[model samples]
Target chain A: MPNAQRKTSKYVDGRWSIVSSQRPKAIRALLGVLFLALSWVGAQSPAEITKQVQANLEKSPWEATVSGKAQLPDGSSQDVEFRLQVLPGKEQVARVEFKKPGSLEGNFVVISEKEVWNYLFLTNQLIIQPRAKANVQGLGVNLTSLGDFDQLNEQVSLKLLGEERTAEGAAWKLSGTPKDKTQGYSSMEILVLKADPRPLALTLKDAGGKTVADLAFKGFKRVNLTAKQLKKYPADAEVVRK
Target chain B: MMPNVVHGVPNAKRKAQDAKRRTVWVVRPASYAVRQTLNAPSLGARGEAAGGEGWGGVFHHGPRATGHRPRAFCFWLPAIGHRLSAIGDFRGGIFALVVAVVAHVLATSQAQSLTVGLFAAPGYISPTLEGSLELGGFSLSARLKRDSLGLGVEDDLEFGPAGRFVFGARGDLGFGLQPLAWGAEAYLRGSVAQFGLDARLGYASAPRAALWAGERNFSGFAGNFNASYRLDPANTLRASLAYAGDVPGAIFQGSTLGLEGSWALREGGATYLAGLGFRVGAYALLGWRGELGEEGTLLDATLRLGWVNRLELGLFQEELRLRLMTTFPLGGVPFEAAASLEAESLRGDVAYDNANGRWTVWLRYTFTFD
Candidate 1:
């Protein structure tokens, strides 16, 4: 009877060990399939990524505070603080405060989805200009006050030039050209985060193959903004409606 | 009684002839009376200063015995009247003809005229057309334009699409002072976007001569001093320095320097133009926000072929353009309509706003008046 009990226990222990050995191999196979699927999804064109980003940006209204230093063309540097409020299915509004080191100091411009208002802080007056004609002169980039993604595609051709890891370690890389020959931009590169496919950086170059502007976004916080916060532009700030 | 006197005069004449074989004759008072009654209007003495001899001395006196000479009094009156009337009529007719010819010549030389128009592209592309009429050293011009674009936004946002259509009128008064050409223009522009007041001063030193200085709202304080020598009537080689900059509140302020040359083949109608340009300095100073710099180098080449009737075909890079244009009699109004198809290959890295590699169709139109 003692020998029979010992044989039964040994048989059970061997069976459990065999099942454990086979399970690990099955799990490895499943993991391999999942990785291949993820890579295939990452290889989509920029148009595909644009569609996805547009859909996601439209899904919710978010607020973000952005702070950065820009290198100006004159070899000078300036610190910029930007406050942005985006409303889903509506226009995005932003207030930018600019501060330079010396004699160059003023509260100048306000941009909404439809218009751009220039404030002369000294005289406390605002100059409203059409969003279409407003000259925001850093890099000849004319942001359409009411442009859609499809219209943007018309202005600049979007192509998925393949994925690349940017110097700043972005999630995805997208490259494109200005389909409109007259659009001053020579080409565009967008660095998007892989986790949410959000654009983290954008660079604009002129027709002469020189970098005109480079923008990077840091500390992005996705928050549901209130309607009141979205309307933060000053009432006296001259509104320029398209 | 007169006959008796004349008989006495004959007896005296016979005695005088007998006494004067040496040719001496005497006439009495009765003979004088008879001469006076028969003499008609006297013919003025011929060669009076030296009236020494009569014609050949054939008779040595007037006709002696002729019947009364018949005179046609009515014929004289009518012939004189007819000649005088004809002379008067011809004088009046010639004056009227001269006046009519002068009026016709003046009317034919006095007509001169111009027209302009503008159109828009599908995207934020705008082009302009202008026409001018030159008359008596002055040119009046009309300009039309369509501009579509987004307004003001910072580096991070997507610009919305907006557009404006503009129509303007300008008058240029030019003076051709030999080695120097000078002109000034005053313009008023009205548009759906903004109202503008424009004034310009221009000086050009001949067509091939290098220096030009002009100011326009769009081009800013622009000066182009290019030294060009004509290789032939159809080709030119040029080296130039050009500068243009805008003030703080103006539209475009970038400055650039360029080197360019043009060649014409098969006459001036077909041309090949090539240019290389580099941006030189700060484009603008936007207050304390930042300074915009004009940075880059551009290389461009274009070939244009024109037909006899002012039809042009242009091949530029990957673009093909066909245009039809003509000038009419009234003020040299030229109407040009063009269509183009462009396919371009792009490779480079651009600071990104919101564009990926893509393809699109572009259409543009413009008009010029002169």
Candidate 2:
């Protein structure tokens, strides 16, 4: 899954204003030149940054744990936690195992290129459906997009809002506007770590500006994941295909 | 249904009664069972295959004779059960409470997942007290059952050379968790891409015939070679061929060649599960399970036309069986129920007796929390 640590809800726009009664023209001129040169070399377009992030993510199979509050389809918020594993290839496969929301604990979902497998722990039943027919949006948000940057880009148009420093490193803040009017979320903001070139957090908001999902990623690392491993389920689990 | 969280004010008095209050609400997992003999008279002398097994190390799917309960954490139930049994008096149901509390504490400390459930079944012949704790891939489930506290932890862990894919227990003697039936099983099943393979072996040594395995359990030595291929995203076809012996093969319901296929159909924005399968063994059997979806999957029903073993009659009896399973909420608690009715009316004997018609019903409440 995308690297994330949901930013705290508290936002304080505390800026220090510096005023100088005496101005040195030459020093100011030098600083302005230095600033422009830095911008020229350091600034990157949103597409370039997003594509680079996707490249870093698709380079290998990785696993991540995501946890936060997510808006339910009914507009209520609930604590949700899950582990996501993405096996990148010509055909990407993603596996999700829910860990929180006690009701959904032990349930798992596997998304292949063509199908989505929802395995219910209580019934030991695997419900399969064509990818197009299945609703992967979880908790009123596109959670799987957190694992696929390309899919995220396809769903929205991204623009680099700014950059900030965090404990992990400098991070680029990207604002996204849903391309599809009826998308679950009207807008979203993502924090992508510059050094690692992967998402660190994502916050989604509906058309009404209500927080839809605030997810954070942690414990992300590449592993030797195999197709057989990703496809494994209880052998006797009743199989149902749709 | 909504979960009823204990929202009462926290204090010494309330805290002291919290465990007791939960004891009244916690429930055992829902267990579904189907029993009764099959008389496949059409096939030669097939009575030996009947599961009314007597105890001579005859392997029975009987849960009451189980020494362990098969679960996702089948690997740990036995050891943990023994530890819990050795802890103190199970008759009081205090150990179950202790296990749940300890498990919950451990999970919270480690940031892991733990599910704790406990229930009492006084309607049974035995005053039964049961509890289970699940932590990640490891679990521990125990039941203080029977008049003499004959607790049998029955479950089998199936492991293939590659990995363990399935593990389960049968509710033969009813809720399958029996006291010290001393049965053991091991097997393996897994899939590689679209091709799936499964093989299993087991042994039953219930203390006595009626209590556990049969005297000459024909279900013993049950083995089968099964492979399933996914036709597409919406369909899967499994081909199973079983031999005369094997404890619990995937196709081990005594079928020689079993061809089964399952399909998931999308209709009116709802999913429906349909399966078609038939088994040709010493006696032929055809069966399939379907989901009755109305405003959701309201019920699961299975229909089977086949032959069953009549151990006493030494013949195969033609039989038709219909089983219905459903889950519903009662007072905010979810309860699972299953009923199977098999009639030999096709043989001109609709008599509901030991020889002709047989039926089994199972009901259990599932109140679980993490």
Candidate 3:
């Protein structure tokens, strides 16, 4: 009877050890699943990242005080300061009013989906021009562009330039190169914040790798713009037509 | 931050920006100039009088009197294997043209080809078909230009890294169909920082045309040197000197040296690029030019204003010129139209005998396709 009792106890102890080992394996499997789920949520694909950026930017109408520089073909450069007011709804448009460089103080530029118009303060001429395929110009870069990411991704090869710390905040740098070399913008680099994915800076380069233009966004804020404000510029009846 | 919150960058970043601004203000003025003439011979017959007979006789002229003696020089750039000369003689022009073409072909075998359209001032309505190839920093481009004035071929080659050394070469040959005129030109431009240099060799002969019944001819070589510094982002100050000498097989025999200082101001609010903005410039000119083997000193001034990257107004001495241009796309092709009008009334001893006020107006157009 004593031998039988001892053998039974040993058998029970062996079974308990096996059960303990299986418990650890079960816990590990659950932890692995949790980690993978977190990573999938946090790390986004390049296309997903671009979509996220577009979503954040197209949330509402916005305004900014923009100051920028543009380099000419002859190696010269120009600097400008202006107030940019954008209406990014279905009827989208952008209005720019010059503030610096006394000569252009009163000049105004209005851009729409159909065309771009310039109003000369001195001559009071309203010069209407045809629209471009894409508004890749630095001065025209903003959250207001319609089909901005679609236009860029379709024409150029987009890649993640990696994470960087900018004046605005931590950002992800993305670069685009024209697939069809003939595009006006040979290459462009944009900085969007990692936290919110809002564009902070845009740089456009020519084929020669010279910086054709660059726009650094500061004091960006959402605004409630009225329809009247976004309407066509109000010129006097005597406005000269060109 | 709330949506309405409107504060700029952090204090540290703002301070850094301020420092950058201060540095630019201090250094840019030392070498900031917008545009300076590089002595290429003027392309127009009127250019002979302003000491400006050379490559792009499109807009402005130089002095009317040359120096005390005729001095010539030549130089070479070992870095790019380029030899440069002013070439006051006809032989030099031919040599430069041949060398430029040969060097262009040899240096650029893998070049990209494309087409471009442009409407320049002074009634130059040009539609161009272009072919080009680029390797590293070197590129060679050839263009066939068709305009109301004539049909021409222009070639340009350039090499250099950005913000460092840049070397450029250009040559053009043109034949006018209606007026029966012939012209050929070669130009070189090189720049390092705030200093720039340009030289040109050119020849043009126009037989009795509809505007003028007499044969108008000019052949010459010109050189321009300039030092420029930007005062700020919007302004530039430049000082330049240009010298032009006559070539063989040409009627113009005198040389002139012109000195000028230009203040260029720009407002970029209208357009993003400096070339597309509202630009205003004032020039103070003092120089000497020679004509009919006679030399004389002359002084003049000019003011220029442009809008929307197209319209331009210029006032020089007692003359006023207006130019309007625009470009549009039609059926996958680009087209440009331009009109220029120059009204002249002589005030002082001038290059042209237009004491009686005269007005010249021209309308031109161009079309381009790939």
Best by DockQ: 3
Task: Name the best candidate (by TM-score).
Answer: 2
Query: lDDT tens digits, residues B312-345, model 3?
Result: 1212221333323322222221222223333331
Candidate 3 residue spans exceeding 4 A from truth: A1-49, A60-197, A200-217, A223-242, B1-61, B64-182, B188-199, B204-217, B222-235, B247-255, B263-361, B367-370
Question: What are the per-residue Cα lDDT tens digits for candidate 2 across B1-370?
Answer: 1011112223344334332321111111121111211110001111111111112111111111111111111112233243445533653354455445655655564321222222121121222233343334433343333211212222223211111244333222311224433333333444422344444444443211112211222233444444544443333444444343322112223332234334433234223333444433122222222233322222222222222211111011123334333322222322223333333321111111111112121222222332
Instruction: Give me candidate 3's TM-score against the actual structure.
Output: 0.37
Which of candidates 1 and 2 reaches a greater TM-score? 2
Q: Per model, how much of the real contact set is kept?
A: 0.00, 0.00, 0.00
lDDT of 1 at A174: 61
Give candidate 1 regions above 4 Å deviation.
A1-28, A65-81, A91-114, A120-123, A130-139, A145-151, A164-170, A224-242, B1-370
Error of 1 at B58 (Å): 99
Q: DockQ (C-alpha) of model 1?
A: 0.02
lDDT per residue as tens, model 3, A145-189: 423565566666777655567877767677888787765568888
Tens-digit per-residue lDDT, B160-273, candidate 1 = 111111122222211111222222222111111011111112222221000111011111232333333334333333333433222112111232222222222213222243
Runs in model 2 with CA error above 4 Å?
A1-38, B1-370
DockQ-based class of model 3: incorrect
- Per-residue lDDT tens digits for candidate 1, residues A182-240, read 65568877676666655677776766766655666565566776544543322212122
Sort by TM-score, best first: what order?
A: 2, 3, 1
Best by lDDT: 2
